[model samples]
Target: MSTIKAVRGTRDLLPPETELWNRVEGVARKVFERYGFGEIRTPLFETTELFVRGVGEETDVVSKEMYTWEDRARAASEKAQSLTLRPENTAGVVRAYIEHKMDAAGGLRKLFYIGPQFRRERPQRGRYRQFWQIGAEVLGPVSSGAESAVRDAEVLEMLASLLDELGVKGWRLEVNSVGSSTDRPRYVAALRAALEPVKDQMCEDNRRRAETNPLRVLDSKAPEDQEIINGLPKIADYLDEASKEHFAQVLKALDACGVAYHVNPRLVRGLDYYTRTTFEFTVPDGSGLGTQNALLGGGRYDGLSEMLGGPKAPGIGFAIGEDRLILILQEQAAEQAESKMDAYIAPVGVEQNAAALALARELRRDGLRVEVGDGSFRLKKSFEAADKVAKAVVILGEDEVASGNLKVKRFATGEQRDVSRTELGAYLHGDQ
Candidate 1:
């Protein structure tokens, strides 16, 4: 028998890769905080109805990709409750907001989350069974359609600024508006009529989409499917007056922020909840990891809360795949030098172990990150190990301890010198 490996669609982020993940996460946190969004965590799994209602029953995530399971606790009553490993964050966040009465908080409630989500599907590059998303949602008091569009532009601008600060290049933002339910159905009819002629020529997936989700057929990437979709009616052309005004406001806001964006008439996102103002950020040159390689995407879901049995609260948000962002950062980092470490502590003799440990703790307490050497290693070996991750190594030996001093070795220059015990901390800080 063959040894089993990680499930086909999942991946392990090991050591150096984890470093990149941390960097990307740090950037996300910093950017989100600047926009006044606090972090919120929801359970990994939620009751199945959340997705069934929030993400439409007709969507691929609900009909195909969700990882659903039975709650065995009610087995005695033969009443097994259905649960699903959350496929996305928005529904759970909204559920928590409603359950906790956050709407009563009286202002815009901004929340962000970073965690893993599960989906059951054939995994490919940039698409996984288990993946991580960094998401943010702003709910409450975004009453005017103009305000909603400004908020959308703000979030997208923040995201774009983050990528720019991190040195990521060659990305493009695609924007669209799917219109309200009132306007969308009419547009769907027009789309169906336009597609009826070539429906036979479309791939099987597009064919099924035509009957179930005609808008999704526009999202298909298969070359022939793209050709068929190109000739189809654009959603923007069929938008009602209110929907057109809403879309115009969103684009005007994007322009005010100097955010570069292209209007994509056929950019209907995968989920069913999306209404007006749908957008996606992608690497246009195709140098990223995934096919079509969208780095982030989202849209307004004005009716989702009400659909899920909550009040009529409208919300808008976006989710970015952290793994994909890290992969992109890794590719960028490869062209640059690695980050430097702060300090390393090499304790020379068993007799001086306690003293070295005490000094290490003191340095850490003073807010410096110090890595101590294992007592089993000799001074030279320990210094060699320290050199790999440290700019300077503190060598604590019996002779140095007896003299109330320590040897401060600078790794980059291969220079060694003695410092008085009281001055050791200052010397290290100065060197740093």
Candidate 2:
């Protein structure tokens, strides 16, 4: 029989690495709570039509990258419904918000989620088919002050705090406004006219983007198109008076909060639902992410709920690419020091295995991380194994069991001591 392996673009998270992952998640949970965001977990997959409507048909996620399938039909009258492994979580969150009639409560709903998401994109370093995202959404009815520019600024400020708390250095915040939904169409139309002539001179992929979705032209990284793309109409120029003031207020709030940022006119992020204030957190230099330096990106979506057949609940959200964030952390810091179990119990004889277990159980019940070794192994062999995995090794032998005193060896200082059974608790906890 052949040994099977993980599917392409997917890999298992194991061991010491999962320690860092857990720490990262723990920090997120604590940090998000400070901002009054409660946890929300949606299904990993949803109906294909949900994404088609929420993520947008023009977006590459729906057009090229989704993992979709048809459900098995049970009856002749039943039609096979299409389902998809979520390429992103926002769509499903909003769907849940609508299904649960959250808007009827007439209050703000702040939800955060951390989980694996699926996409069939070409994988590379820090980019996988199955990746994790730490994301949150803040949405509510207009009467509840959800549409105010303060909400946008608060979200941005919260992200700045999150990155700082995580000890991410050299990070940069780039903010932009693609205008409101109404202002975007006018900008898109302007881009079409400008691209009609110069697009033929651009690359093949960009040429397609120019015709299908011109906002993506600004997002193109092709070197040759940079000159032409720069000369294209800026969204800032097309912004209506309301949108201009909304963006100004967002920036003003950031200024008051002492969160420094830059305005990048070309930063029209890769999503269709973004409007008003759009921003991305990036590490400009010294990041292991290379060309894909965006740690997270999001913006105000005043119309996304309505787009997905929900009520007019305006909101904003951001998703940190967990894989990329961890990569950056790993590169920025030295490898995490090896974690040591509290104690390893090494039995001196095969007959004393039960005794070692009893000792280990007592230590564990007292909340120590205890590892029990086989009694058959020689003391020297047991010592070597214990040294690798533990801070101390308990020498549980025949003499110690009868005398009610246990021998404990501290690996760090190469110190050994004898302690009565009652004193073992104090010794383990450093009270001795």
Candidate 3:
């Protein structure tokens, strides 16, 4: 028989690593809840039209990276539908918002989600075809202040708080404004003209982007194209007065909250929906993410609701590259020791195995993490295994069971003690 393995670009998340993932999610939930955001889980797959309409059809995510298929009709009267695994989540979130008619109640909807997103791109380092994201979106009708610059700053400040709370150091915040829908066409026209002559001098990808989506050309990281990209028309120069004021207000609010940021004129971001403000947080090189160090990025999409066939709802959101975030944390904690269980129960003999199991159950019931060893193992082997997996080892023998006391040894301190059965839970719990 041949062995089957996980598909390329998809890998298993085993123990210890999953522990770190849990910690990150727990912290994210706490921080998001503190900001009045509730959890929202949308389906992993949606009608392909949802994305084609929400995320522009010309965007790389919708064009080249999507995992799409045509779902067959189950009945003669049923029609086939085009389905796609979500490459990004904001579109789905907005789809859900529109589907549920959430705006009918007339209030801002602050929702967060943590889950897997699929993108069929060349995987490398922290980039994967199947990756995890921790993201949030805030949207509502115009009357609810959802379009206010305060909302943008509040979201930015909340992200700053999350990174700091997670103990991530040396993160940089880059901000920019891509202007509103009315201003976008003008800028795209300007960008098109600017790229006409020099497009041939750029990389193949940039050349394609120049014709399809010139704004995406600014997102190119090809070193050979940097010189030409720098000379391209800045989006800031084309921004209308309304967009300029909106960006200024966002920056002012960030400053009032003591959140540091750098304004990058060319940071248009790679999303067609982004309008007014766009931002990204990045870590320094050598942070285990190599050259792909963007921790998260998002921007205001004032017309996303209407674009998705819903009422006029303005919104802002960001998606954290959780896999990259974990990589950075692991690099930072490289020297830290692995955590161990509270106690391991080692049976002195095969005859004491039953008794050891009973004791383990009791300890576990009282909230202690207990691991049990088989009585067949030799005492030395038991000690070695216990030392590796647990902070303390409890010796289970005929005499100890009969006397109602357990022989315990602390691996770290090498101290031995006799703990009564009634007090074993407290001792294992570090109450002693």
Go through the candidates in order and give each one's C-alpha lDDT. 0.81, 0.90, 0.91
lDDT of 1 by residue, 201-303 (tens): 9899999888887888888888867776888888888778888887898789889889899998889886878888899888744556746678889988888
TM-score of each: 0.83, 0.84, 0.88
Candidate 1, residue 108: lDDT: 82
| Candidate 2, residue 215: lDDT | 84
Ranking by TM-score: 3, 2, 1
Q: Write the per-residue lDDT of candidate 3 for residues 1-432, one digit (tens) a residue.
A: 989999999999997578778888999999999999999999999999999988999989999999999999999999999999989899999989999998998999999999999999998888889999999999999999999999999999999999998878889999999999989889999999999999999999999999999999988889999999999899888889999999999999999999999998888987778899999999998788877778899999999888888999999999999998988878877313334778999999999999998988988899887899999999999999998888899999989989998899998899999999999898877788
- Residue 400, candidate 2: C-alpha displacement in angstroms: 9.5
Q: For this target, which candidate reaches the highest TM-score against the unseen true structure?
A: 3
Instruction: Work out candidate 3's RMSD over C-alphas.
Output: 2.9
Model 3 stretches with alpha carbons more than 4 Å out: 75-77, 334-339, 346-352, 378-380, 391-432
Clashing pairs in 1: none
- Number of the candidate with higher lDDT, 1 or 3: 3
The lowest-lDDT stretch of 10 consecutive residues in candidate 1 is 333-342
Higher-TM-score candidate of 2 and 3:
3
**Per-residue lDDT for 428 in model 2?**
78
Tens-place lDDT digits, model 2, residues 145-242: 99999999999999999888887888899999988888999999999999999999999989988887788888887888899998999999999999
